[model samples]
Target: MLQAREGTCNWKANAASGMAVHDDCKLRFLELKAKRTHRFIVFKIEEKQKQVVVEKVGEPTQNYDDFTASLPVDECRYAVYDFDFVTAENCQKSRIFFIAWSPDTSRVRSKMIYASSKDRFKRELDGIQVELQATDPTEMGLDVIKSRAN
Candidate 1:
């Protein structure tokens, strides 16, 4: 059996103005953050010292997916997101949230994510990614959160 790891995913401002986290990395994080309606933007792939860096642009994106998707491809695209971990209704539970907008063409199943909530679901880190694709938030009986007026 697999075990879960206790670690936090850091959200930083995007290094590049127009980038996206590749087509595959959009996970539940993006979904949850979008629900929060935080102000942020995505950027395309950024390479330095032969390594790839994905981060939040620190800029607010109008259409989450559209902004990132707008990243220059043929070059490479990545969705860099910014988020804060705060104590939600469940004090003991820390909520990692993100706000984003993606086109309908964008999919949550593209990349691997940390499937379940730390205490609520599976106990594996990698499992989260697998689970992300396994279920659809809107269709999985999740509450419908309406978008606020801009």
Candidate 2:
């Protein structure tokens, strides 16, 4: 079994414009502090299995399967997609949360992303590059999530 280690480093702004753990060595829980929304975007990665398990901390739970299905490929060696969106109860605007996990956890290659501006999402896997875009926010997020999964 893989040991789950939660990180407690000070939060810093990421390239995607959200708060993330300062140190890159931790691998248990990554918290993405939403700028627009106070709610947090968090998830965990299993180092041994190379799988990511996302918890619905402040996001809707109903669309998780769809989020997983929309991945670029049917199977993935290492990848993760997590985010928060506008819901019926939460009318406030929210940014999309994404985590691109590298296949090798021993090295630091994963990405923490928070996007809400563009329509297109791009990613590269196993030397293959893919770009996805949609007019809809949900679809666009799904496309990005799916692309990373591949």
On lDDT, the leading prediction is 2
Looking at model 2, residue 118 earns an lDDT score of 15
lDDT (Cα, tens digit) per residue for candidate 2, span 15-106: 23232222321222233231222132233333343433443334334355555444433122122233444555756433334433222222
- lDDT scores for all predictions? 0.29, 0.32
TM-score of each: 0.24, 0.20
Which 10 residues in a row give candidate 2 its minimum summed lDDT? 117-126
Measured with C-alpha atoms, the lDDT of residue 49 in candidate 1 is 30
- Worst 10-residue lDDT window for candidate 1 reads 141-150
Give me the candidate number with maximum TM-score.
1
Count clashing pairs, candidate 1.
Answer: 29
Query: In every candidate, how many clashes are there?
Result: 29, 2
lDDT for each residue of candidate 1 in 1-150, tens digit (9 for 90 to 100): 122222222221222122323332344335435553433333322332322233444334444344334443223222223322224353432223222222234434322111111122122112222111212234211122111100
Write down the lDDT that model 2 would get: 0.32
